[model samples]
Target: MDPRLTLVVISSCIALCLGCTKELSVGELFYGSVIETKSSPSAKHCQILCTYELRCAIFTFSNFKCELKRDDSGAIRAVSSSIISGRSLFSCAAEKKEACFRDEYSQVAFKDKPYQTVRTTNEKECRSKCDNDPLCSFYTFYKSSAQCELKFWNLLPTAEVLYSSTGNLVSGYSSKLKLNINAKYNCLSIQSKGYLLENDYFDYTYSGAAFTVEHCQTLCNLNPFCRVYAYRTNGHCRLKLIKDSHTQGAKLDYVISGLRQTDCKPNFVGKKTTATT
Candidate 1:
């Protein structure tokens, strides 16, 4: 082999092994199931944070904050242009690592929510204050006055009302925010009437005539890999599989879809048993 070609092959292999490449979806936000949150300066920095955590499979970056999610199973919501969501392809054991820079939103301010105001030379130092303070959720820095305002919410508000645009202001979230996962809440029974989740299937394992939606659910329940099912009024049943992630579907007329609350655990009998009505 040519020496240049050999080097190229070696580099490619190393990149794949470390999962250097990431798949980013701009203007997307994954709801719920956040394992951890941190302040990030850019989408690329957010990906690095996701890569560092063993449990982080996907992440969403918005308003200079990075939300690390356990998987891609959560509902993906289209949000503002600032939001960027992506999946990490790297393994936890990868050798390559990078330092994180302070992420800030210029000409933006988080309004009417400052709990503590302090003096700081730059946004990086301002961010450090928020990172150290447990109560701080976000902070805004004023460029001309060199003022840093650390803010926290008594109750978290909706994303729409989180930030506002202003000149000479920079804002960002805390560097680290660990979320408590309630297993019971995360594993709730999900059912949607009159909807068909389109183009979101991992695999279409089985499809056949089913009497009712309940019957289609039963079919999904029996399959070890099936995580979601869709039933049509015309008696067609479709079972889909997405291992270890919840499935989100779109709405369509005359269709019903649902997600299996619990993981599919199959118990094998002495012989293969036939499923009956």
Candidate 2:
């Protein structure tokens, strides 16, 4: 009855569909490339810096170099000369694609740190958290544990497709760089009084609280800027102020002790991964 109106509606619908489409691709290595590089204690540290850079999808770093690239299409490959090994970083940050994109997953981006433990919610909140933090590069959240881990690369495989229980745990796109630099060093590591020297310090202590050393470490790890930690039977987590003495506190469920450390590494490197697909 209204042929002209129907025709106009169909044309508009087609335009909308065409407006929202994108193509996707896959390969052995992904993200992009390392357009940059810097000196770091280890390859991981270098990777960390590269991951922080916008458009730094993947990189290869050595004592002398760091490389970044882009991979939207093709069976691309990278040949290396300097870096021992390099890989991509992980990401869970989603993108709002136009409606024409067929894949539902294509629209969602993941986030990965200063990652607050995963709570039930949407990517917007997670991204908001990351965006606010100057240090956060990307993030990934686990559906099972509801744990969110922040990341460096453009990708965040916070969703572990394949994983090993122990040995070397690589995230979605992470690999240790086989740099000429020393492996014992990284951007961050744990420090205790015994590990380094002390000059100035502060300690806030509590008592009669029971906790395991393991539990104490978890608390410290969770803290945003927790450099080191000490726990005793007194149920206290000494967020200590340390100096040149090189002393570290303790972690015990029911023991009494002080906390301090020296000679601790510069940054903490509990674990890391690059987001390559």
Candidate 3:
């Protein structure tokens, strides 16, 4: 989430519970290095925009100009303003939201092949894409190339940090801790019909009636007892109610086995059933 957008969302939620104003005061600012600048409508919007940015430690807005700065070394505060200055509450709120921790290294990238690749407009969007993918542990984004590489491994291949002279590449890792904003169901990754598993027995069989793999996965997600499932092309969806049932390297060509990656395991005894034509 964008920090300014995040603040806006939080403020809205807080307003619903308790009526509050848009005023947010962090503290008096000093000299800082300007990271980026954007046109802002109001002082509050500028504050929110600054708070929304990860690197923006402090910001000031005047005459529709918002200057976001990085104040890690405390040098950006030579001049302070009370009319349009605010501090960032992102770190504090990030803990509550379980936001992904980021570490950016300029001109650095992983040498090994990435498990996945996606295109994004900015580094922030690229990082967010990696955060959403369960398999992605780290990622690299090149501004000039416009390529986002999502890697499965946490560590870089070479001990030496990759460097770029032009300073177009930025790389980082995802914290993996994510907030389950979706209250209904925690769905797993969906694979094609070619993917199948062995040793996993389905406890119950349901007539899918021309249901797709997506539909069967949804059904499994909704049912508490379902842990794994197998969906056939003929609309036979089998829901497994046991953990560790999926044996590695067990492949059934006709059945598509879908595994649920949840912390909760089924305890009740399940009866085996066959699909009826």
The best candidate in terms of TM-score = 1
For candidate 1, write residues 195-261 as lDDT tens digits: 6676643346677755446546655654435677887766567877765444355767777788754
Q: Rank the candidates by TM-score, best first.
A: 1, 3, 2
Superior by lDDT: candidate 1 or candidate 2: 1
Q: What is the lDDT of candidate 3?
A: 0.53
Q: Stretches of candidate 1 above 4 Å error?
A: 1-18, 27-42, 45-49, 60-68, 72-83, 89-93, 109-116, 120-139, 150-161, 172-277
lDDT of 3 by residue, 62-180 (tens): 64567776563434343444346655544344223333334566776656588778899988988899878866656889999789998753211111235467789887766553322
TM-score of each: 0.34, 0.22, 0.31
What value does the lDDT take at residue 153 in candidate 3?
35
The lDDT for every candidate, in the order shown, is 0.59, 0.33, 0.53
Candidate 3: list runs displaced more than 4 Å.
1-100, 154-160, 177-244, 247-277
lDDT of 1: 0.59
TM-score of 3: 0.31
Q: How badly does each model clash, as a count of residue pairs? A: 3, 90, 11
lDDT tens string, model 2, 91-135? 311231111111112112232233444453544454455555533
Lowest summed lDDT over 10 consecutive residues: which window, candidate 3?
264-273
Worst 10 residues of 2 by lDDT: 96-105
Comparing 2 with 3 on TM-score, the higher-scoring candidate is 3
Question: Which one wins by lDDT: 1 or 3?
Answer: 1
Ordering by lDDT: 1, 3, 2
